[model samples]
Target: MIEGGALVKNGHIQQQLNQQVPDASDWLALSLLPRLGAGRLKQWHHERRAWPQQWLEALSVPQRHYFLYLRHPQGHGQVLQPMLDWCTAESSRALLHPDHPAWPALLNELPDPPLVLWAWGNLACLEQPAIAIVGSRHPSSAGRHHAQAFARALAEAGSCIVSGMALGIDAQAHEGALSAEGATIAVVGSGLDHTYPRQHRSLQQRILNAGGLLLSEHPPATEARPAFFPRRNRIITGLSRGVLVVEAALRSGSLISARLALEQNRDVFALPGALEASLSAGCHALIRQGATLVTTPTDIIEELGGPWRASSIQGAENRPACREGGERQRAGHDPQAQRWLVLLRDGAVSLDELVLRSGCSVSDTLNALLALELAGQVVMCGNGWTLSAPSSESGAQTR
Candidate 1:
């Protein structure tokens, strides 16, 4: 029985070895070196493309030490053997260096692309036309609704929605795309081994089951960290043809994604929001700085000029209009809040400007903006605030 079992195991190993594509295990192993980042490794990979031995010889002592450490730890060939064995065992699930046919073409366009992307699920999704929807973790009701509606429309038109799978806007965007039975990609900061927010576990499973993708540059078992997210944002923008900012404060991470998208030459579309709301300020700022202003998904589709089926306009029509009225009239019910909204009405003004203009203390003005934003009386645009579109009754009242 032992002999028979050994024969079966040996055959399986032989089959795997035969089927294995040229393992860039050597290249990937190089990435594990603490000193080498994507830029440096790319340079090394190109030089090694010809005269491979000479490439290894070109490294400095420190570089050489790191390389040798990965290759044969502590001079134990047996230690190195296990790593290669593990690579071989996991070869089917692994993606190698850039030369592989499965590597995304989009990554090549970036100034710094990952040396190797550890991917799972349908690799073909990488080739699809995609758009990124990103925004605050804590979004207003309007912001959440807008993200979902926009994502649904874009997905129905055959565009894939890409996002960070975060809470608030990111979560709603994914749900919207899925609800429309369209493809979406979640570029997570955490590893595939565990979902970051924990609440989104079911959503993650749904994304996988629905022919969508869940991608991470980080290897499995990696933990979430603040630093990883900023790095991950680049990938989100890198994967998309454009990025849409739903709602974000001035320092929101979504703005970081927007900035990266611009640097990558991806189109940036920001939804216009009231100038007075802190939450909308980041997006408004981007628009003022020349990011395309998008009020509907069609605005985006028209800009892209892609072949997309137009869904019903009902969704667009249902969106809440911006609140209207001078800061004083609107603030009548909330006197302190009215003071802050009045300060924001003169166009996009900074928080500091609001403090100066409102005559209220800094803490008091901030509290007022928060209350006004939740009341849908104001929305943030970029680094400033603005009045929301008023309801018909409110408009009449103003008149």
Candidate 2:
């Protein structure tokens, strides 16, 4: 079985993906229609539940002809079949339609929510309390460090960090989260099939290995273009409780995401950089425009709180991601401690991850971890806890 977003090898796992969902194909077809862009689609969303019918009914003659063309073999093979195959290509891959339980409901608050989302890796990250860290593709060295530090801090505090998976600040933010063994999500402009920047292929795989997610709106194999990047920022902001600008020039796209966050009524946080630095311009602008100026991860968490806390917005609490856990453990340490030991068998694990993987509440996990530390069974190593010596649970022996 796929343990951590491993791509299907033989291209199997085709039986239950997207085939059973109601109106799934219709939604995918709508997303793929060449002439029907998100702007036009949003215009007909006044009816919400009935918008699909409205979209079908209001299609112009050419649009209707195009839809008909999609039904034929030639158009189906060229435009639709690849996506169909990609969705069923692996158990880790999924086409997240609105009806799919994995679909992020926060996107619905947008004026234009995607009809179908291309999701890879852990779907649970979509529902977790997320904070978006965005900024310039070219940032100062200090800017890069801040991005990584803030992301790592927030992640260790149990928030899923979101970013565009771009160079500079975005890449550092994702890396920081993975280093903490914390959850993260990358919302990219191109299709899931293509990794933009080419060099980020390893970073992408690391994210999935850490139980993170990679998301895209485009169909598989679709190449990136100049226009796709700006549009993808909306999804990045939409997925988070707030947007943090590490470093940005006034005219940069980071400002665009901050503007979108403001428009969506989501919080915007900015870090103050050197006054003479051009990279600090957009953030200064944001602060002047009333975005929160944050210096620590707590500021972001206290301001936005963690996932379980009450949110100013709805839906954050309405639907929690339900995970299927392993069989109950018996003997040795308490059930919570046992789960922790099994997970840390390979190596160290962060407190946030211990809470997440062990299915224990924050207090319980911390208290048990402390007991282990006191008993010399485990020790704090860097940002995570590791076994101090061989143990019955770990099955490791000292020479």
Candidate 3:
């Protein structure tokens, strides 16, 4: 991982973590070594299984000299102490070594796997089956629609949505998964604490609040830089079983992720865009290069050897907005909230009752209700939550 300028391998690292031994500190110190990238980290691990001890003695002369410099007070204070303090925030953050259950096995397939992965939010989302949806940072409305629709279908079918958390396609995908009450992982280019694109800070928090995850190779304090993004792309592709390019210009980073996906032996799926649109050029190129042309979530699930869960896919279909209080629900409102509105139409119900009726967590139910309320489709009274106004005979919910 790029966090704090170090590399961390999985197996032996896990042993040190479990023992709560000083070796863990040694691992952190090793990661802080100047210019020590994943390739050299792997080499060091192979040559000496016992790291930070025999591991140091086995280092080449230059590496050992560099390590000696970092061992000094100035170097240690500057490079390692911050990471130690950041990792100590155990409630909101964690460092994932190779052996951590949250670690993705697909990352091991990379020629240069991250030595350690820095993560914030629910770590369990890492273990779920994932599909990456990426495209231009500035997308056409149609492109945004496809990204959201496909992500929702995949998420409903029990797949975790993964993306770079960029503005256009990535944000739509994350919103789609969250709307479905599904897991999403945002692989950020900057440190967990330094949210890039600043606008997405709310989105990042929502991901955490909804039991999703935010991941970074950089440590908590690392600022976002252009160079860090390509590195972030690799992790986005690495954690996924397949990658879907919703839209991209010829020079887009989404194409970079698609290329990396192919390199990592992950399936690459691209949605066809307009013939003349520049945004479609990269996706078209990928299709020409043998990427699967996909129009729906089943194309991904089937290609990745996952079951075709018809029921789950059915749950993601869009429904019409309900007109309540003689006011139409906002356009593009979440369909999931309409399901909750149906439950609330009869009368106010307790949060527990909503959970029971909807089979969703209290957090998810509350989030849906909040969205509905914000859209003026539902009201929360002393009784609990109820439709803000009576629904038509057909019973549609706005948001």
Scored by lDDT, model 2 comes in at 0.73
Ranking by lDDT: 3, 2, 1
lDDT of 1 at 375: 53
* Minimal lDDT window, size 10, model 2: 313-322
Candidate 1, residues 12-116, lDDT tens digits: the string is 323422422324545555556565667755665555544234444555556655554444434324433543443345433444367778776776677777766
Candidate 1 TM-score to native: 0.68
* Cα lDDT computed for each candidate against the true fold: 0.69, 0.73, 0.74
Ranking 1 against 3 by TM-score, winner: 3
What TM-score would every model get versus the actual structure?
Answer: 0.68, 0.70, 0.73
TM-score leaderboard ranking: 3, 2, 1
User: What lDDT is reached at residue 381 by model 2?
Assistant: 55
Candidate 3 off by > 4 Å: 1-23, 43-48, 52-54, 66-78, 307-311, 318-399
Residues 130-185, candidate 2: write the lDDT tens digits.
99999989886567656876786677667899999999999989977885678999
lDDT of 1 at 274: 74
Q: Give candidate 2's total backbone clashes.
A: 0
Compute the lDDT of residue 349 as modeled in candidate 2. 79
Question: What's the CA error at residue 6 for candidate 3, in Å?
Answer: 20
